[model samples]
Structure formats: C-alpha cells, structure tokens
Target: MKTYLPSTSYEYATVQKVAGTTITEASDVLAAEEPLEIRLGYGPAGQRQHRTLSITMRTPGHDFELTAGFLLTEGIIRSRADLTGILYCPDVAKDEERENVVRAELVPGLSLDLPRLERHFYTSSSCGVCGKTSIDAVHATSCPVLPTDGPYLDVAVVHELPARQRAAQALFEQTGGLHAAALFSPAGELLLLREDVGRHNALDKVIGAALLAEWLPLHQHVLLVSGRASFELVQKAAVAGIPIMAAVGAPSSLAVQAATNFGMTLLGFVRQQRYNVYCHGWRLVNQQPAGGPDKVA
Candidate 1:
C-alpha cells in the first residue's frame, strides 16, 4: 500500500518493541494535499487568451482531466470537442508545485459567462459539495437520460466493485481518510480509480481521465464511489453520461431525486453482497425473481 502525505504534515515513525528493549521503526504515510489552479484560455481567429478560472485544492495526479471534467460537469463546457487543450503550467518554478496547477484551453469562440463564474475562484477538497448555492443549479444542467442501449452489468459484476476499488485505493490505504471514485466497465471491471480527501475531486479525476481518453458519453460504464452518494456526485456522473452509479455509503435526498430525474440507476450501501436500489431499479438485474431487468430502449 502507498501513502498520501498532506502538504503541511510531517511524517514520523512508530517504534515497535517490548518493554525496555530496542525496536524497529515503521514509516508513516502522510496525506497528499495541494492546490490545483484550473485556468482557462479562449480566443478567436486561431489565437488564444488565457484567464485564471478557478483553483481547487486537491490531491496530486490527473490535474488535466480534473480541470476538463470540472468544467464539463459544472456546465462551463459541453463536450470534449469544446476543449482545444489541457496542460500543466511549465512556468511554475517549483517542481512539486508545477504538477498542482493546470490550464484548459477552450475551443476558439468559447468563453464562460461572467455571472456563472464564482467571485472567489478557489475551492478546497473539504468543501466542494457545501459550496453550492442551491440544488436547482445542479438540476438545471443535468444531462439528458442516455440512450437505453447503454451497457448492463450482472449482479455478480456489481458485487465485485468494492473489493476492486479497495485494491486500487493506494492513497486511502495509507491515509485511511480519502474518498475514492472508480470507473468500471459494464462487465464490472475496474477501469480507473482515484482517491482524494474530497469525494467530488476523486470523481472529477476519473471523469477527467475518461475525457482525456476520448471516452465521452460514459454510458458504456458505471461509476462507483467509496463514500456516500451526494447530489453533486450524481450531477457529475450524469454530466459525464454514466448511466449507472453505486456508492458504498448512503445516498442523500437530492442524489436520489437527481438520479431518478436523469434516468440513472442509483445504488447505495453496497457491501457484503447486498445493496439498496434507490432510483431506476430497472437497471439492476436479478434483483427480483419475478422477471429480468427492465428494458428501456
């Protein structure tokens, strides 16, 4: 297992020994925390103009996708085609700090609306969800229900996610405090997993990575979260076009409502070979012995 060190924390070792005897020292893993500035560039006629869009304090890795996915999920941009390029600023003098900031260049002729931009463009991993002004804002930009030809998973497939997520959770194993988001194929195979102090950031990393892979319309897969399913998580998944979502914890009221609205199947408290289907139960196969999973196409 790997460790995640917080930006400001000092790592120490614990000595193991019997009373009055010498012992061995074991290294402690610290949480990884840093500020990620998501900048944007826009211009017409093949030129580009840049602006500091927002800064989100997040765990390291996947900064490019995190920025691109954040914009897509926030409705700042619509699709991968709307992006010209996403990159980390090479001008940052510090090597460690250089990986913390990213610039996303929007396609020519595209610019964000001023009023939609936050007055203070800084967010931390601890407060991404509570920072929302209202639930209506999330609902307004929710993606339409994906076409029914979306992928389906077996009950066994759904059951394997927790363990798969656990295996990929190197950061969580070290810190024991991070949340994780994993993308799985329709067959329940883990595709990508990211850990962060904030659940939304984990999700954004996965979304961002998927976007970079040219895998938009994530309807072909499912998203699994290591924490409770919040409304914002549902909104992000819907925006990414993932048709199914599962969480190891409970679902918030708005999450269930939003999942229902977006025609996504929402599963929660998934563990120990059992789970609760809160919305769009039609997506779960073999849940009821009476018949097969519902066909929506």
Candidate 2:
C-alpha cells in the first residue's frame, strides 16, 4: 500500500499593504501552481511505449492522485487494475522538476484507442467542443447513467456541508486561493477532501483517492465542491457513479443538462440553509413539489 502526501501547496510572498493612508510591509501566502506533465507507459514487456498524455497547471501536491484521476476521468483507464504503478519520473535533470512529471504504467498488453484520446486532449485544451458534442462524447464513454434509487439527503444535512468543507480546507484557509472537492456520507459526515488551485484538479485528486481505496461507483455518497459546478466536473462524477453533486455556487447550463441526462441530482447555491435542486429532486427527503401537486418544477 502506498500513501501520497501533498507537497508544498503554498508559498510566502512579501508585499506592501495599504490601509487608508498608511502602508506597511506584509507577508502573503499564495497558492502554488506549477505545470505537471502526465506520461503514460504501455505495450508488452519487451517493447514498451511511452508518451506524454497531458500537461496541466495545478498546485504542486497530491501529484499521483491527480495523475490517476485525470487518466480515469479521461476514459484512458477504467480501474486501479489498469495501472501497474504510478511514480514520479526520476530522469529530470533538476531537483525542482523531479516531482513535476509522473508516469502511469499500464498493464502490459492492454489496448488503447490512441486517436480518440488525442482528439479528446486537443478539444479539452482548445475548449472548442460544442455542448451537444461534449454531452454525446460523455454518453459514448464507459460512464453509466447514475441510479435514481437512494442516498436520500436531508435538507438540514445539506445546509451544513459548505461550512464543513470550508473548515476542513487547510490550504484555502492559508492561501485563500484554492478550490476544494469533498465527499460526504448521507448523514453529512465528511469522508474525503482535496484542495488545489484548479477546481477540476481538486476533484480529480478526490476521485483518485477513492479509486485507490477501491471506492468506485460512489452512488451512495454526496459530492460537494467549493465553487460552481461545470460540465467537466459533472462528467467526472458521473463516470465515478456519484448520484448526488452539490456546489456552493451556481451550475452552468451544460452542467445542469448533463446531470439531468445522467439522472444525477445536482444542487446549487448550497448555503445559508437553502439550495436549488436543478434535476432529480426526488432524491432529497421532504422536498416539496415546486409547480403543482403532481410535479416538482
């Protein structure tokens, strides 16, 4: 068993702060961000193939989990079994750059659709995927439609999530510039949390941790984000089989639509003891019908 600890997530910077007319030298904590290149190794024993899969700007910590989560969400690898090992590249010339590169070695003889992966990586980098095409691509992946059965959440429990997630965010509290993703039980017990400068990276770390722990198909838990929900985040959660996703901020239209299409319960503005349920309201206990007696609008 291996455990990954976060590297330096924040750094100190000296700045001058002006209050009214007075200026004073002060030290500020800034969230660290660096480029992490994820490489992949595959093929058979004798002749192995290696390629750079992605290079993302993220806070330097939880590098392994970030790599694992990125591969899983991209549909590059399905399970932990798909990977033989994940390690930082040791061939870098500089010490600072050593942890910036990681290699996820796939099981020998496993097949990959390289062209499709290239297309996905290109579209993601360019942000040029149309809404319909993006949703359709999600449907084309191994991700399944979420179950509508249970994990019935209590409104009171949901109200406490934002505060709880905030309190547990050590990096956010220090730097005040990080996003967080948290997993919680139906009873509002915080299960796992990860923080990073990038929202998606934070989520990938959480999902990667869950995958390492063999906790896939998170249909029985609720996921909460410190920021607004996006289509990419929803797609990742759907791929991980999470039934409920709540964000402290608003959700994009595409996020709402994708959640609806996936049969997931999406909640937004989850603070101050209130929230708006965009889709699948039936999963919330004691939720009243909005439009009329027969419907929940």
Candidate 3:
C-alpha cells in the first residue's frame, strides 16, 4: 500500500501583505500544480506498446481518471470497457515520482492508433489539445451529432447549479485556486464532482470516473463548470455525451461556436437566478414561444 502522506494538493507558503503603511507576513496554502505524464499501453497481452500520450500540469490525485478521461475525449478510447487497467507506472525511480507518471493498459486484442496518439496535443495547464485544425476536429468519432431531443434543462435548475457546484467543491473551498466540473441529472440532481488546478484536468477526472462507472454519453445530464467555458472544455463535455453545459463565467467565442455546431445547450453567467443562453436555447425548459419569455429566464 502506498503509505498515507499529508495533503499534497496544497502547500503552505509565506507571503507578505502590504498595507497602507504596514507589511504583514503570513502563511497561505496555495493549490499544488505538478507535471503528470500520461502514458498508454497496447498490443498483444505480453507485448507492451507503451507510448507517452501527453504530460500536463494538474493537481495531485485522480491521476488515472485524468488519463482515461483524456483518452476518451481524444477519440482514442470510446467507452469504459476499452480500458484494461490504469495505474502509476511501476518504473518510477523514486517514491515521490510515482504520482508524476501514470500508464493506462488497454484491453486484450485492443490497441491505440499510433497516428492518433500523435494527436495528444495538450502541452500545458492553461490550454488543452485544441490544435485549431478545423471545427470538425472537435467532434469525436464516438460522438455523433447530438440530437435535439436529448434532455431538458430548466432555467431555475441551471441557476441553482452553480450554487450546488460551489457547495460540492471541498478543495476549492479550502484552496480557492482550484477548478471544478460537476455532473447533474436532468432533474438538477448533483451526481459527480471533480476538482483540479487545471480546468481541463477537472473535466477529465469527472468524465473518467463516469466512464468507469459506465456513464458515457451522459445524455440526460448537465455539466456545470466552475470557470469560464472554453472550446476545449465544451468539447470534452460533448465527448462525454453531456447535453447541457452551464458555466459560472463567460463562454469564449470559439466555445459558443462549437456548442452551436454540436447542437448542445450552452449557458453562461449561471448565477443568481440569471443566465445567458449563447446557443441552442431550445433545450431550456424556461424558453418562451416565438414571442418573449413570460418572466425572462
């Protein structure tokens, strides 16, 4: 068993706070960010087609989920059953290095496309692997264009999602420097929540877990992101089969465009019982007729 260690998600650091005429020095716990190398394994049972997928900076914990989730959205692994096993690489030279690298083993007779692995484009914590080749690149092979009849999202439920998502963010409550991705049912029931210093990493963890729990193409679910909705984040959600995505911040221009292209409902500034629907407002249960909304959702 890997022995228990103190929290590595946050570390204490001393900083000076400058006032009008005084300088106060105190310790603060900042969210931890470290490099996590995600590797993939395939080929015959005895043969290891090991290859490095991508190395991203993420908060500690949920390393395997992050790896699986990344592969799922990348159009590599389609479903949870495609995953054979995921663990920290046994080749770590030191104990502390164990958490720095993760390897995912594919199921028997299954293998990854070597050329597709080249598409592993994430190189940092801020940006995900959106190479901007084309709008169609964001669409995964496993994800057909979302139909118009997936799930219904009420404006009231959308407004409540941010508060509920905030309540479930334990790490964020402590560090205030982490991003969160939460999954909710069509009825607004919070299902799963994951947090990380990287926005992309947070979505990866949740989608990875859902994939394991056999919950792909979460057609009847709503995804709530704690930060701004980016094209990459929306792309990840769409890959996971999520129909509606609500964000507490603004949606980027590309993000709005992609959501519109995918026929997914996208909501922004989802707080205080108000939100803006950038695209696919048809899915909002509070939307009005050809006229205006009765009360303006």
Give the top-scoring candidate (TM-score): 2
lDDT of 1 by residue, 1-297 (tens): 346444442234464645567666666655666788777777885576677777777777667778877988878887788987888888777877666767887888786676557632333233554424444565566474565765666777788899999988876776677889999997878888887777988899899888878898888888999999988899899888899999999999878887887788889988887778887776666554533353221
- Model 1: residues >4 Å from true position, as ranges? 1-26, 45-48, 91-97, 119-142, 289-297
- Quick one: best lDDT, which candidate? 2
Single out the weakest 10-residue window by summed lDDT for candidate 1.
288-297
For residue 100, model 2's alpha carbon misses the true position, in angstroms, by: 0.4
Candidate 2: lDDT of 152?
Answer: 95
Candidate 1 lDDT at 154 equals 78
For model 3, how does the per-residue alpha-carbon lDDT over 102-148 read when each residue is reduced to its tens digit?
98988877755675556445333345444354457656365556767
Q: Which model, 1 or 2, shows the larger TM-score?
A: 2
Model 3 misplaced stretches (Cα beyond 4 Å): 1-6, 119-133, 288-297
- Higher-scoring candidate on lDDT, 2 or 3: 2
Clashing pairs in 1: 4-30, 4-31, 4-32, 5-30, 5-31, 5-32, 6-31
* Predictions in order: lDDT: 0.77, 0.89, 0.82
Which TM-score value belongs to model 3? 0.89
Candidate 2 residue lDDT tens string, 1-297: 333235477788999999999999999989999999999999999899999999999999888999989998888888999999999999987888888999999999679989988988998899755687788877887687677678799877888999999988888877899999999999999999999999999999999999888899788989999899999999999998899999999999999999999899999998887788899978898655566442322
lDDT against true structure, model 1: 0.77
Could you tell me every candidate's TM-score relative to the true structure?
A: 0.81, 0.94, 0.89
